[model samples]
Target: MKEKVLILGGTEFVGKLLVETLISDQSKELYLFNRGKTNPHLFPNINKIIGDRETDDIQKIQAHKWDYIIDFSSYYPASLQRTLDHVNRDLKKYIYISTISVYDFNKYDRASSIKEDFPIVDCSPEEAIDQTMKTYGKKKAACEAVLKESSWLNSVILRPSIIFGIDDPTDRFYYWLRKIKKETKAIVPNDGTDQISLTYANDLVAIILKGISGDIQNGAYNCITHDSISFNELLETIKKSTDSNCEFYHKDNEELRAQEVFLPLNFISNLYYNNDKIKEATNLSFTTYENAITAMVDHFEKEEWKKCMIEIDDEKLIS
Candidate 1:
């Protein structure tokens, strides 16, 4: 019998990629558990368990025994708790896609690169109750904590940095690609020395696949693929990938506010996370910045490199 793999949130970027990759694997049978609202028509032949996590609608989940549960949809501790209550105790592994925001950057010095064992954000029960953007990181931390307390669940928690690729909703990375292709003078932020770590969606999926078979270990792993890189370095990588003739200059915070400009990717000089643990564990090399950005360029090229639904007066900001 094929090993049963159930994925939660299988319609969007990373989840969609996982489903497509797993579909071809002969040793595993794939099933997706979601509300069936997003891209409802996608993967028509794959097994789908339609239900809402908020309402605890997981009867279908209880009916089946899962070999592996890849959870990309559980944003709340309660949602995860509900799923745990329904699923069987026996499983090879459970993989969860979490975020690096779970780490308390303020707790560390600016130069310290975060590690898997770094102190995670401490969340209170009252704070977790608020389901807003402000509580997102804290709530995710709570989710991981909840998983740790689950004595019967064998799990791997993957906390990735900003995930970038095709169908990217935030458009933080895509913005630079479009800016480079459209204009010659790229208005950068304060010398663009801020450090960041990005997880290419494809690379992330690659590690997820490795987790399925390799001598898998269970714990919270920082899933970032690359070392912390400078934002200016990132800008140049995008430029090289697209072969764009772009020049850049920096402007400080006050000037940016004067122009009413809001840039993406949280451009502040800070230490992102370390990826050495994940690399050693998965024995996987990540896609080069150019290759990853090239993928982005190709996907956006079909759309004629259109604005990613975010408006900015380039001329005004550059001036």
Candidate 2:
């Protein structure tokens, strides 16, 4: 008997990698539930239900009893609630690809290490419906709230910090890669004190696979294993891995934005998580920063390079 698996968003980034990993396993039968808009041709042999999860179209998925429903698409609570109404939770395990953004920065006074038990940002009714990037964390918190309310849901929430890998449409991490590869001098965000945690795609997929194969406990777990990296350490890693000659200068994130310059990962507090829970549950290690950089460098192509070609007046910032 084949294990029925349905991926809510299977065409992009981490979700795409998840699909690829499952394809190798012959015991799992895969089904994709997406709008059929993104990279539709990526999976030809797999069964796909093309519909918007926000509307009644999501009902199409309820026809089958799935062994696992991996959701990467739910941003708001309403969407998740609607989808859950259609799910036969009697037999399926649910895995949510949540972000570490769910942690409220206001809860901390400085760079502090947080765990799954930490207080998440509260989502207002207005913020729940809005789709702007500003309300993203709150809305995700709202979705998590829905999961918490559903006491019967056999769900495992995996909150990952800044995800970095190949085929990443979001040019956050790739922005640094481009700067290191092309430019000589660049202005990095803030002083070198701010530390950030990142999750490599391969390691994240391994934890998700562990949940799928084994009986994972129902709760949220921070998916990153590495301790943390400071702002200077991040740039040095990128430079060392690529052997680039880029000179980095210091500038506050707000200062750069005031000059009409937008940089990625303008984080306020430290993103380090106490990952002892995940570490104890699964004996999985992570990709070293150097090796993860190599993977991204190897996969960066003409399109990705073209994305890096944005005209940023680094000289103005440097001066």
Candidate 3:
């Protein structure tokens, strides 16, 4: 019998890729639950359930038992709790796509890399409702807590760092790519020495499939590239991929902040993570940053160049 797979909020970004990956396998039955506000007609042959997780509409998801339920869009603790309450007993395994932001930088101060066991930001139930970027990490940590504490569910939490690929709405990674491709001069942060972690959306899909096949052990795994890259290296890779002669000028973080300009991939704290646990458990090979950049640049050049073009103001960089 084919395995029943239910994906919550599988209409965009990583969720969309996950849906596509699962549907490619004829041995798995795919079901998507979302608000249906995005690309609702993309997969006409598969099952689509329309409902809002924040409202009473979410009850539409509890009708059937699933072998695996991958949650791609549960950021708020309340919303996650509601979903868990409904599906805890009905699903055999739960996979939550979390972020490395959940790790508390302050607690791990002076540490070069973060592990799954690193301390996460502490937030109360009251504070988790804000849902802003400032509180995003704390909120995700809370959601992870909810899943772990649930008695009826066996869960796998994947903490990815800066997920990027085609159809990404955030434009965080694309911002630098576009800047390098269009401009001769680009402003970088902190002399471009800060280390950063990134994950290709397709690689994340592969890891999730491995988890579904019971090849990856259950627990929280830092889902990112096996190796982290410095910000300067990242810019060089983008420059090479775009084949652009972009000269990068390193500006102090304070200066950039004073100008009200924040560079993407430049984090306030070191964003490196140790992927030894995941590598040992899954033995999966991740895409190199250079290769991932080449893929992203190619995709943008072919399709997203026109639709997702971003204008960088030189005056803002100078001010």
Error of 1 at 181 (Å): 1.2
Per-model CA lDDT versus the true structure? 0.83, 0.84, 0.82
lDDT tens per residue, model 3, 1-319: 9988988888889889888778889889999988889887788999988888888777777787788988988889988988877773756689999998888887776656778888888878777899578888899999999988887778999998888888688788888888889888888888788877788898998888888887775689998864777888889989988999988887898977877776665664466688888888778888888888898888888875754344557545755
What's the true lDDT of residue 277 in model 1? 83
RMSD of each: 1.7, 1.9, 1.9
User: On lDDT, who's better, 2 or 3?
Assistant: 2
Residue-level lDDT tens digits of model 1 in 33-97: 89988889999999988988777587678888889889998788887888789888998888988
> Model 2, which residues run further than 4 Å from truth?
301-304, 309-311
Better of 1 and 2 by TM-score: 1
- What local lDDT does model 3 show for residue 196? 74
Q: What TM-score against the true fold does each predicted structure earn?
A: 0.95, 0.94, 0.93
Ten-residue region with minimum lDDT total, candidate 2: 301-310
Model 2, span 163-272: residue lDDT tens:
88886777778888888887899887788678888888888888889899865788999887577888788889888877899998888878777787877755644756
**Cα TM-score of candidate 1:** 0.95
Residue 237 shift from truth in candidate 2, angstroms: 1.2
